[model samples]
Target: MTPLEILSTTATGLGAGLALIIAIGAQNAFVLRQGLRGEHVGLVVLVCMLSDIVLIAAGIFGIGEVVQAVPAVVVVIRLAGAAFLLSYAALATKRAFRPGALNASAQQGSLNRKVVLATVLTLTWLNPHVYLDTVLLLGTLANQHGDLRWWFGAGAAMGSVIWFSALGFGAKLLRPVFAKPGAWRVLDGLIAVVMVVLGVKMALGI
Candidate 1:
């Protein structure tokens, strides 16, 4: 492919990946919360971007077909994802209803990096939507570029890196606003709602 063609294919992949991932979801919510708290932001962003890279690559390389061929895998993921989300939703609800204010600094002090990493992994991998978006949709889309498919996949991976970096870093700018307990409550409430909705939808295959 010519230079122009490669650039165009990569750009197309970037746009498609961005379009699929820009939506609201459990992963986004978790990243935002961690960013706000300034707790393991780098690790969270790394895990998220890396996970996307792996999934998108798998899809582009044809593992997407293998995944699609096994409906049982998706079913298993759906059930597990639903269970995890529901459990997270309950925790968020409890936090939202707590009498005390949400203190980011105080909360950060209490957090275990290992726990955060584990949660990040769970949020990234357990969600069925990640496979659907990164592996299946982005993979299939990249393959449409023919020989340029690898470049397309590269672009999609770049897009994921860009987005998660922006979200995790840019969120610090909003730290002032999140300093208040009321703001934390509102944010947690929104997260709880999102988790519950997604969990139920996954459970019902909606």
Candidate 2:
């Protein structure tokens, strides 16, 4: 590929990944919450970006095809991921409705790095859509160039890194917005709607 073509391909890859991630979801919510609170910003961003890289790389390396071929396994994952998504959505909605401290970062509890890590890990790995995007969609598209597959993968990984870093840090600028009580409600509610819709779509094969 020419330099210009390479740039174009990488840009396209970045756009594709960003399209999937820009919407409100568990990952975004967690990252935004951390950014707004100025807590564990680096940890949250690193986990999210690394998780995407690993998942996307695995997808490009034929692992995704193997997993997709196993219908039984895929179906099980679809169901389990659906359950997790819905549960998260429910929790978010409840939080949105309840009267609580606005600054969750100030809550009386450990940051729970393990809990946060596990949540993103599960959401990244278990969700069938994640596999479909990284493995089936992006992988197939990347394979079109045969020897240049790695370039496509590189583009996607770059996108992931850029996105997580931005979402984590960029959200900090919105601290005043998120700090307002109404902002949390709006944010959490939007996330809840996104999660529940995504969960049902996966469960119902939409």
Candidate 3:
């Protein structure tokens, strides 16, 4: 591809990637919460970014085709993802209703680094939508770029890095607002709702 073509393809991929990722979803909610609480934010961002890169690569390399060929795998993922989302939703709901649960200082060490890592990983990997978006959709789109598919994937990967980094690191700017217990309650309540909706949709295969 020529310089102009390379830039165009990469830009297209970046746009497509951002379109899909910049949304209100379970993964985003978790990342936002961690970012607000200032709990292992860097690790969460890194995991999310790396996970996107790996999935995008898999899709661009024909794993998307394999996934399409085996519907059972997706079904399994859907069910598991729903279960995890619902479980998290329950926890979020509890936090929302429990007074002082969202206290900034109290939440500092409430969850250990290992637990936070596990939660973020589960949120990323177990969510079937991640595969559909990063693997299948992005992969299909990149392949359409022909020999420049890798360039497209690179663009999409860059988008992932930009988004997660901003969300996780930039979240500290909102610390003042989140300082109030009421704000935390509202955020947790919204998170619970998002989780329930997504979990239901996945569970019913909607």
Candidate 4:
């Protein structure tokens, strides 16, 4: 493809991705929490972006097609993802009701690098909706560009970087709210509701 075509395709893909990922969800909430706590926001953003790049690249190379053909894999992922989401939702609901504030410098929870990596993996890879977002939707939209598929993928990847960085930083704005016990309760409740609803949708295959 020509230079102009590549630029156009990438720009289109970026726009599509930004539109798709603006909603409040588990990933967003987690990143925001970390950011507000001033706990490795850059690292969180890096992990989120890198993971997205891998998924988007895989999708561009036909991972989506393979996944579509594997009905059993799809079912397994949906079931597992739903279970996880529901569990998380329950925990969030409990947290919401619990009268306690989140200490930003809480020396209680350990944040080892390996644990952090695991956290990113579970949040990014293990989430079923992420597959549909980066793999299915972005992949199909990117493939529409004929020979400019790479450009589209690049743009989508860039969007992921921009988004996670912005989200992680923006989350700091909520530090005051997150510091309050009631605010945490409310946030947790919202997270619970969203997660449970999404989990139910997945379980029902809707």
Worst ten in a row by lDDT for model 1: 101-110
TM-scores, all candidates, are 0.96, 0.85, 0.97, 0.87
List ranges where model 2 is wrong by over 4 Å: 1-8, 101-111
Worst 10 residues of 2 by lDDT: 101-110
Q: Model 2, range 1-206, lDDT digits (tens) per residue?
A: 68887877777777777777677655677687677767778888898888788877786777877876787887888899889989989987887787773554433244576877777777776777777777777878777767677777788888888888998998778876665656777777887898898889879977
Model 3 regions lying over 4 Å from their true place: none
CA lDDT of each candidate?
A: 0.89, 0.76, 0.90, 0.77
Show how many residue pairs clash in every candidate, following the order shown: 0, 0, 0, 0
- Mind giving the per-residue lDDT tens digits that candidate 4 earns over 14-62? 8987876777766777787667657777888898898889988888887
Q: By lDDT, is 3 or 4 better? A: 3
Candidate 1 residue pairs in backbone clash: none
Error of 2 at 186 (Å): 2.8
Cα lDDT, model 4, residue 28: 78
- For 14-103, candidate 1 gives per-residue lDDT tens digits of 898888888999999999998988889999999999999999989988888887899899899999999999999999999888766465
